[model samples]
Target: MTTTHGAHGICLSLLSSLSLSLMAALCSHPALAAETDSAPATRTLIQAGKLFDAHTGKLRSNQTIVIEGEQIVSVGAHQDGKPGDTVIDLSNATVLPGLIDAHTHLTGEPKFGYEELGISTPRAALTGAKNARITLLAGFTSVRDVGAPAYADVALRDAIDAGDVPGPHMIASGAALGITGGHCDNNLQPYEAHAQADGIADGVEGVQKKVREVIKYGASVIKFCATGGVLSKGDDPEASQYTFDEMKALVADAHRLGRKVAAHAHGGDGIILASEAGVDSIEHGSYIDAKGIATLKKNGTYMVPTIYLNTWLLDNADKIGLPEFYLKKEKAVAAVSFKNMSNAIKAGVKIAFGTDAAVYPHGLNARQFAMYVQMGMTPAQAIQSATVNAADLLGWADQTGALDAGKWADIIAVSGDPLADITLLENVQFVMKAGAVYKNNVAK
Candidate 1:
């Protein structure tokens, strides 16, 4: 679990070069050969039919993006080209900044039912790698992996970053912090059986210790179960798990360490407590009331309503192989997710894009876009939640979310305009992350 950070150094460097070559081959057109030769030595021009400017929410027409190495040198009307550049002609497709998922567990674990009968850290890591590739191909170039057992997500994040695996740029939380018997604790069998999860901490002092421990072990963000969750057994989803004092302690400790806190809260009391505690974002505010929403709004807390998980869970419950108690819990929560999220959105609460991805399947993260639109957000606004809003919440507004000069060259292309039909986002035809192309639909 505690491996060296630079283990895959050689592999990642080679993968980076391969990523560039793949894009060059895919975007090169015979007719554009002269333009390519005249371009900069390491520039790639992307001809976009329609581009979603996440910064302005305005779709520009007939745009060409200039990329040099892992940064966007310029994006707009064509500047003159230098020699030996690559040109990708997506003149038939609509282009948008790569999508971001704020809450995702890249490492696989049964969301409901089984609890943790036969799972292992290595198995979870492999599953995470697979899911990461699927998610990247789906157009999510960046994701914040919230939690996994034994810091598995940290390994996955490094793997993807090192090019040992193809996946989204990740901000890994390492593990979620929970009080003993709280939602994130591995409360599989009775307490007499075994205390397995490192996440379980108790009281203000304990939570503060846990926060420091996780950060020391390489957690980029900190997560806590402020309330009971739908998948955990024996806890009422409406019950607040941690006291306000405990939450305040956790948030203050994480923030003082320069880390943001994501609170997993369902009940109204917990949501309000987390908001008031200065957590950066609240996850799954299923039982939020008007007062809770107001508190979140007034405090500038972002809500990551994972609306799609309920539908996916109900539709594929049998495949999940959960224990009977967990299954019942999923059934109970599934019935109310839509209404809960819709009301939250209608209330004008600040929303960031998050999908409880492991609860459903991983690659299908983009499916949440249409659900967001159905929940009263315009397509443009929904797209922004996954882009600009998510970036801002992650404190990466300067680097990743939008397509602009001096930002990472993370971009994706689709066959149609997502602004007109948000469903088009579900099928990302081309994917490029940090100037490397992992998927190209236009390639022969």
Candidate 2:
């Protein structure tokens, strides 16, 4: 009886060893190994009560957006959440695509005028980290940061991309290319100070080289001063800075390197020159005239009207300690900006939403939507300028203009229909970007 028990135990041990070897062989096979090693895809279900169809500029009721990882798998009528899916219930709010701002300066804010002289590059980057969160929570998931001193915008963008900081998806243009003493230059100090902005370049060759330089330093887009600016010292906003030949060279080099160009043009001649030179967009366009409007339309150039800054600056100039020099330019630009912008809108020129955020404050970007409507755009058109138009301008039309399938899941929600009351956007209650919820006040 003992011998028979020993034989049975040896047979059981051999069988267990054989089973383990067979399992290992199967797992070692190429196809079978991949199947066993792969993890299940993560999914997040969003139940939206009224989803705004950005493509049609209409609302669809009772929608479910299926998200896997960071992409939207599908959007259809309401469906029950599957097991193992994280569900966000925005059933009581109005859901829309996340907003975009074409012109922003995240690295710095209006520091009560000349106090900006004391801000160093590292300090600017730290300030950007704070403003990035504020801007993201305000429902602007993406922004085109037009210019930052010393490549601070590039560093900020990299930090955000690495998940080291919370911020919007940034299309950063390092230091804006400018001619000597132009709006993009540092003109505050005397000649003895040897103050020069990194973007300062001289003639056509110099401008082209500067374009390449900024792009090499991680500029996704090239921004050049086509005209002077209101905030800068010792330059008239209406004066043309970069000549047409130089502008053409700058745009050519930027486009060759696969980077779009934005021209800071607030004068009629500057706008025309920039449009004819093939720039993608014109920032400010404060002094755009009939000829300039025709040129922009003919070239299909977008005009980013940052009209809201005028009101904000005028109202807060004293509080901000804005120097009389800058204040005078602001008043001059503000005087004619509204009429020209309204005319351009009425003439059916292409428009993209840009608030010039740092000129006033971050997180107040939505306040510009109401101003767009007042400037002759319908509420739907105004919203589309930020979504469709801005996306097209940024060359991200396929990635995130709307909440479509196979797109990044960037979405925002307000309490009511923004079409009925555009001002509702100013108080976004829920915000989501790339399938992650950054702000969700609507959820109880």
Candidate 3:
């Protein structure tokens, strides 16, 4: 059975790669192209003056990338081209792979509370549809939405895959699980309100059941609240929500189902406990300590330090209309989160790109790159967090991590060299996903 499955996987990947190559050849036939001169043309070749590869941390100059549909068949000079073949001259701009954000909440808007309560599941899907389009245009070709209400993220992911919506390739966790009155649960009202979240499960049996239910509902990943959160009501950010046994069940079940687990843990004990449970990644880690850092490193667990959300909140909290409790929680957690993240980075734990995008606006996900650079990461290291490392975490390393041959043509360009000034990522001038140009602001 294992051998059969392995063969199946290989065949699937080969088919995906071959389809792009076939499309590129079919789309660029000079004779067929001239015959259909009245029709629109797809890009066949891209000339890049400078390329920043996240894998090598070096900038190469004067390179050619040949795209066959959505995949790059070759990355070296290939002057032989049929007539009417489309060429994109990005010699004036620095090109690289499209950005990936491993952490996002497309369905949930910026504010959460009474306003969030009012939004039904269908409304959440609608919001995801809008946010997904904006995120894609911002040069994030792929994103993993870790949490959403009412399984709305499932609907959104399907819609995007079906071409019913314009968005990044998405891996969606249908709903984030937690205990009663914990971060992922409905804490705004009493149980009498009948507003309990589907994720509010307890004990090993309870969490196991919930994990299976979420997977049954089409969740590509499993997200469980290991610790309390700042945005949620009636929970201290420093407390653990799931016990070790419960977390173990969640992880085991999720892995058995072929899904990775992302633990939303802030407190030190919770991070440590979640690591012990074999959770694939730790989110927030606001109060992570030396012990927690060691545990993460020992387990090879990835840390998704969402440092920018707190900073963005601190800057715009007053305008966002956060409740008083949330304001206090934000202030308390922001500094601790930053300090812990700095410590974790120094500890040398594996890290990935994950901006809690719904906490701020969706399109501004690239802002996290700047914060990563601020936290002791070199410019290339920062870029890798959103490309190579992020893609590895998302299991898309084969398809979309770098601008290499046989990978998806998810490319972006910036006017300035990000190595010289990391802040240039904030302004993505060009975006091409799956061989389709979504935004091109280059000057003629």
Instruction: Write one digit per residue (lDDT tens) for candidate 3, span 76-111.
Output: 653545677788888898999999999999987787
Question: Relative to the unseen true structure, what is the C-alpha lDDT of residue 384 in candidate 3, on a scale of 0 to 100?
Answer: 89
Off by over 4 Å in 2: 1-22, 25-35
Question: Each candidate's root-mean-square deviation in Å?
Answer: 10.9, 5.1, 10.8
**Local accuracy of candidate 1 as per-residue lDDT tens digits, 1-444:** 543347597677778889999878856866577675675356898888888999788898988899988999888964444567788888889888899999999897445545565778998899999999899999999898888988989999888888899999999998798877778877777768876577888889999999999998889999888998877767877888899999999999999999999999988899999999999999988888888988988999999999888787777777766667766877776677678778889888889999989887888998899999998999999999999999999999999899989989999999977888889898889999999999999532
Please give the distance, in angstroms, between residue 266's alpha carbon in candidate 3 and its true position after superposition.
0.4
Each prediction's TM-score versus the true structure? 0.88, 0.93, 0.89
Assess the local accuracy of residue 66 in candidate 1 as a C-alpha lDDT between 0 and 100.
Answer: 94
Error of 1 at 118 (Å): 0.9
- lDDT values of the candidates? 0.87, 0.92, 0.88
Say which prediction, candidate 1 or candidate 2, comes out ahead on TM-score.
Answer: 2
TM-score: model 3 vs. ground truth = 0.89
Best by lDDT: 2
Q: Name the TM-score of candidate 1.
A: 0.88
